[model samples]
Target: MNKNNLIYIFIICFTLISCGKNRIKLISENSNLILPKDFKILQNETQSTGIADFEINIMLQFDENNFQKIIHQVDSLILVDPNWKSSNNEYYYENFTNQSEPSNIKIYKHNKTLKFVFNHI
Candidate 1:
């Protein structure tokens, strides 16, 4: 193909691949989650009482369905902890559910942390 044709094709392919809807769909399907408006992510490292030497932090907004599902599956979830002290951990959900307004939820671990801001509206 000519140089111009090749450039046009590349642009078209890039545009198609960069479509926002596909990204949104992938995130939603993979996490069974829906993010709130103006959400953001932050990362950090820290020590924990578990198996891992250090934890990775992931901060974002919360989706109610995903949050509930995660709470339910916490026991079965495989958390990456460097300390390896405990295999099972319990989370307090009543505080979350009883809130009159949605609140930010922070999950900490030896290897990872998740921060989720919940919006009631």
Candidate 2:
């Protein structure tokens, strides 16, 4: 291959690898979880204990609008009453009974941030 062709291939590989390292796949696949695209992801972690058991934790810096949107989407389904930790923060837990995809989700909100924990077993 010519020098130019090799340089182009190297650049493409580097770009894909760099982007993959930072990409969060669950955010796109999770239909039940809705988060604004503008927020900065502070943390994203996933653990798999078995073939069909996994847990995902994500924390983001969001705005008031995003926070309200999440609350509204899950309002009617929150299984556990929200526990207010402080004037500016609270937590919500929701459990799904669908046998095909039994799972639980926890949401916590502080002034301008939200943390989501999702588990499927």
Candidate 3:
């Protein structure tokens, strides 16, 4: 093959491998989860939400339907790759707490489509 052809082949192969080399696939397929009610993710778990402590209701259970396993699995992967580096995909987890909710909620968001929701309790 010509030198130019060889160079092009190498570049294409390199791009395909490099494209996914750093990516952390949190899930084979993305699943989205929505927070119940008007509740939104709290940036800080410690911050007071201005709601009555007892009034908060945030009890969540992890199940196959909710796909909470992906979040937990990613948590373990983060230890291996502390950066959890990804080229196209995003992995995010946040501690959520509200004034009325007695339980703590952990929200795991992967890219735009994959989301896992579960309570800390």
Top candidate on lDDT is 2
Over 1-121, each residue of candidate 1 has an lDDT whose tens digit, in order, gives: 8999999999998876665334334333333334445433453223353553322233543355554555545434324322112224323211234243333333444323345332332
**Lowest lDDT block of 10, candidate 3:** 22-31
- Estimate the TM-score of every prediction: 0.25, 0.48, 0.23
- Residue 62 of model 2, lDDT score: 69
Clashing pairs in 3: 56-100, 56-101
lDDT of 3 by residue, 9-35 (tens): 999999766643222121122222232
Instruction: Give the Å shift of residue 105 in candidate 2.
Output: 3.6
Which stretches of model 1 miss by more than 4 angstroms? Answer: 1-56, 78-121
Task: Name the lDDT value of residue 15 in candidate 2.
Answer: 82
- When 1 and 2 are scored with lDDT, the better candidate is 2
lDDT of 2 by residue, 43-96 (tens): 777678699887767677767887787666656334433421222356444435
Q: Which stretches of candidate 2 lie over 4 Å from their true place?
A: 1-33, 50-52, 72-88, 98-102
- RMSD of every candidate to native, in Å, equals 14.8, 6.2, 17.6
How many clashing pairs does model 2 include?
0
lDDT of 2 at 40: 72
Task: Assess candidate 3 and give its TM-score to the true structure.
Answer: 0.23
